[model samples]
Target chain A: AQSVTQPDIHITVSEGASLELRCNYSYGATPYLFWYVQSPGQGLQLLLKYFSGDTLVQGIKGFEAEFKRSQSSFNLRKPSVHWSDAAEYFCAVAADNDMRFGAGTRLTVKP
Target chain B: EAGVAQSPRYKIIEKRQSVAFWCNPISGHATLYWYQQILGQGPKLLIQFQNNGVVDDSQLPKDRFSAERLKGVDSTLKIQPAKLEDSAVYLCASSLEPSPYNEQFFGPGTRLTVL
Candidate 1:
């Protein structure tokens, strides 16, 4: 079975600071990875995805993720985060036509 | 394009009671999914539908939970004799197809509280 792991339970960052959220996956075959963000009382929104071709994928809201097959990791990065960027982030992996998601990391932006 | 739609943004019922949730997928989408999200955890898929047929439902607790996507457009999930553990947000999502590469659009979700 495919699984996704997000190590950080919560992270507090100052506004305008760089941000990186770690994600790791366990799968036997090639994995399709994705990053999603959810604000309070809102639905999950797609930030980015990686299927193949190019390890780095840019997403909406000035976010990007790099898929490193060697380490089985796909980490999301943002050069500078705004206060609005504070939300819960989820990493997902697709396998056997089903998608599995990580526990999610809650981001807090200090203004 | 319109995103997925779900009704009853909030639901509260006593334990052992029954509840149901409705979802409308985006137009022209062939794949629909239902997920349960507990507080502090990511959403976990309960069932999936592809054009009015069940694609995957291994994680669904068939003993009390039942879902149907009739006519391949709208879906409904029902929980009979609910438990306290079943209190969570039920999210509905839709995709163009039943492939791993396709992106999924989600609805606001129905927050269920079992007292």
Candidate 2:
């Protein structure tokens, strides 16, 4: 079974600071990776995904993730963080008909 | 186009009570999924349906949880005699296909608080 790991449980950064959330996966072959954000009491929204080409993938809300095959990691990055960007971020990997997710990382932006 | 739609934004019930959640996926989507998201955790897949047929439901606790997608459209998940541990958000998502390249659109989710 494939699984995802998010090392950071909670990350706090000042407004306008850069942000990077780490995600690692355990799988035999190349797996589909996705980054999703969820606001309080809201559903998970797709931020970006990595399927194949282009190690660096861009997504909505000024988010981007880089896929490193050797490291088995897909890390989400943002040059600058906004207060509204604060939310719970999830990293997921798909295998067969099921998708496995990490524990999730909570992002907090301060003023 | 309308995104996935789920009913009853929130629900409160006591232990051993029954609860049902409804979901309407994006039109023409062939794959629908039900996920359980506990607080401080990521969404865990409960079941998956492809065009009204069960694809994978290995994680669903069949003893208490049941879900169905009829006519390849709307889906409904029900919990009989819910337990305190069942308190969480039920999320419904739909995708054009089962592949990763296709984005999965999610509904706002139905929050269940089992007391």
Candidate 3:
């Protein structure tokens, strides 16, 4: 069974500071990777995804992720995070025609 | 294109009560998914349907949860004799296909509160 792991339960960062959320997957093969963001009481919005090709993939909202097959990781990064970027971030992996999600990391932006 | 649609943004029911949630996928989408998101946890896949047929439902608790997508467009999920643990947000998502190339779009979700 494929599963995702997000080590950070909650992260507080100063606004306009760089941000990096760690994500690791447990899978036998290279599975499809995805990052999603969810605001309070709102639906999830796709941040980005990695299937193959380039290891570094760019996503919406000035975010990007680098997929490292060696480590089985796809960590999301943002050079500068805004206050609006504070939300719950989830990492997911898909294999065997199925998908599984991580526990999610709660981001807090401090002014 | 419109995104996935889910109804009953909020529901409150007592133990042993029954509740149902409706979801309407985007037009032309062949794949639909239902997820259960407990507070402070990631969304868990409950079931998946491809064109009115079940593709994967291993995680769904069939003993009390039942879902159907008739005609391959809209879907409904029912939970009879609900339990407190069942209280969570039910999210509906749809994509053109199950392939990774097609991104899945999600709905606002129905928040279920079991009292």
Where in model 1 is the C-alpha error above 4 Å? Answer: none
State candidate 1's TM-score. Answer: 0.98
Alpha-carbon shift of residue B51 in model 3 (angstroms): 1.3
Local accuracy of candidate 2 as per-residue lDDT tens digits, B8-90:
99999999999999999999999999999998888999998999999889999999999998889999999999999999999
**Which parts of model 2 have CA positions greater than 4 angstroms off?**
none
Give me the runs in candidate 3 sitting further than 4 Å from their true place: none
| Candidates sorted by TM-score, best first | 1, 3, 2
Better of 1 and 2 by TM-score: 1
Docking category for candidate 2? high
Candidate 1 chain B: 10-residue stretch with minimal lDDT: B97-106
Residue pair clashes in candidate 3: none
For each candidate, what's the DockQ? 0.89, 0.81, 0.82
User: Each candidate's chain B TM-score?
Assistant: 0.98, 0.98, 0.98
1 against 2, candidate with superior DockQ: 1
TM-score of candidate 2 to 2 decimals: 0.97
lDDT of 3 by residue, B8-101 (tens): 9999999999999999999999999999999989999999999999999999999999999999999999999899999999999999998777
